[model samples]
Target: MVRGKTQIKRIENSTSRQVTFSKRRKGLLKKAFELSVLCDAEVALIVFSPSGKLFEFSSSSATSTTERYRKCIKNLRPSKQMDDSQHFEEEVAILRKKIELLEETKRKFLGDGLDSSSIDELEQIEHQLEKSLRIIRSRKILLFCERINQLKEEGKILRKKNAELREKYEERQLELSIGQQFSSLEQVKEVETQLFIGLPNR
Candidate 1:
């Protein structure tokens, strides 16, 4: 029968857990030693047990190997920092060049630096200016049209008001004329009555 794979988990029993720790620790140390001897490599291993026991292995003096590892890491940090600094400098240079190009383009747009521009560049600028002018003119025309429409509406309102005022004035005049005619007829009747008050002159 094929043997079943053992499930790896924490051993709850103190004795069993200690036994497992001891076996694994020995096996790990043995592998470290073999790897160092077979590959002629510098190897270091360290382990701390649950009981605060220490186990360690090294192909050479442990303190020396640790020092070497620290020095190697320290050396690698400077190299990486230098690479990063160089990259930063390169980025700064690229940005500076871009800013200069943009400033030059701005000067050209403002018609300040045309002596250095080629024929094609001049033509491009000319085209851009023409397009800008066209846009400006179109906007101007639109504003004029809106203003004209606004004035037309205002004029129509004024004309309507004037017509209303004229109608009111005509009605007032007609009322005044009718009142004067009635007053005149009353005066004429009073004069004739006074003249025939006593007797006729014949």
Candidate 2:
């Protein structure tokens, strides 16, 4: 008869639970020991009952086997130190190349490395310089024209003010001249009357 699968629920009775724990613990230790002996492998098992009694088994010294496992895990994993060193070396190489490129460019801009450049590159640089110069000259001419126009406007205003001042001065001078003429005529008439009066009394 095919036995039905055992339902794997918790044994609720305290006596039954303790008895089951003892049986299972022994079976587990026996299996661990047999596997170690048959396969010539290191093995360790530890179990504790509900009352805190310890049961254990080891094919080799438990401490030695645990240490060996740790060493094996360490050897199987990659080294972070080596990876960091390699990454730093790669970054240094990239920075060095960048510094070299920047230095070369700086030398070119300062007109110190033209001999190393190709003819085409020199022509391109010359063309760019010429274009920049032309644009600068055009801007200078426009600014100068604007300044000249502004100065011309100022000169026109000054000329108009000078003409007005001149007219005012001329009008004052004409008034002064007429007053002087009237005073001179009055003096002459007084002098002639004095001479005629003195001569007629004689």
Candidate 3:
């Protein structure tokens, strides 16, 4: 008769647990040794018991096997990290150079550091300044022309007003002169009538 499969569970009793640990440890070590011998391979195994006792097995020298494992892991480290470091350094150098150029340009604009400039640099600066000066002078001339035109318009308006006022003044003077002449003629007629009335011979 085929027996039922055994149910696997942790042993509750401390003594039974310890006994199971011992048996399993031996079985694992024996299997590791058999596999290494049959396959002609290197193998290492280590276990620690609940009682703090150490157990180990190795087909070769354990220390040498551990050292070899460490070396292999070290060799497997990604080479990309070194490449990234080199790239970062190159970018930093480029940024530093850019910053230096910007500082020099700023100094030139402030007119503080021109002694070290080459002839070509001086010529370039002079050309740039001359271009700017030309633009400023052009703008200034345009503004002056606009102001002159405005003043001329205002002068024309003033002259027209002055002509109208002068015409009005001349008309007023002519009216006053005509009224004085009429008064003078009436006075002469009055004097003549008085003379005729006062004279005896008619």
Candidate 4:
């Protein structure tokens, strides 16, 4: 049936809105079901009314539909770790450019020997190189210092554990020594008794 062309706006009447929502929801679900059954295609739809009521439909169970959605979306997504690695590569490229400039300055300093004009240029290049070298040295020192600190911390922890183990080992050794002493005393007493029994009258 050809109904009158309706203006696309919010229906002011609550009852009319509710009626339209119900009818449209049913029609949408019907179309989805028909598409899935006739075309053998997977279909999913979720709807929420302005009143905060939820209505959902899927060709599969709710859990299966969510799983399918995840699979579909993830296939189109880029990995985060790969993106971060690319950023790191870009930073490395900038550092490479700095190195290239430093090398060029060095070649100019050497190939074109230091005259008055060359000396001025040499001094400028030297200053820039010193700055770069200082930065590089500082970074290297920091890296090594951090590594040394980590090693020292590890050594401290190991020493504490070694002290604990040494105490335990000494305690075990003392116990074993006491046990051996008891065993020796018992042996001596047995020998004494045997000697006394075999002795002439005292």
Put down candidate 3 lDDT per residue, 67-143, tens digits, no spaces.
88889868764776688888999999999999999999778867879999999998887888889899999999999
State each candidate's clash count: 0, 0, 0, 0
Candidates by lDDT, descending order: 1, 3, 2, 4
Q: Which ten residues in a row have the lowest lDDT in candidate 4?
A: 109-118
Candidate with the larger lDDT of 1 and 4: 1
Residue lDDT tens for model 4, 1-202: 8899988999999999999999999999999999989998888888999888888888877678889879876876477657878999999999999999778766765655345446677678788778989999999999999999999999999999999999999999999999999999989888743345565986
Q: Residue 146 of candidate 3: its Cα lDDT?
A: 100
What RMSD, rounded to one decimal, does every model reach? Answer: 27.2, 32.7, 32.5, 24.2
Which candidate has the top score in TM-score?
A: 1
Clashing pairs in 3: none
Which stretches of model 3 miss by more than 4 angstroms? 1-106, 192-202
Q: Rate the local accuracy (lDDT) of all candidates.
A: 0.93, 0.89, 0.90, 0.86
Writing each residue's lDDT as its tens digit, candidate 2 over 103-151 gives 9867776688898899888887788778989999999999999999999
TM-score of 4: 0.38
With a 3 Å backbone cut-off (N, CA, C), the pairs that clash in candidate 2 are none
Report the lDDT of model 3 for residue 90: 100
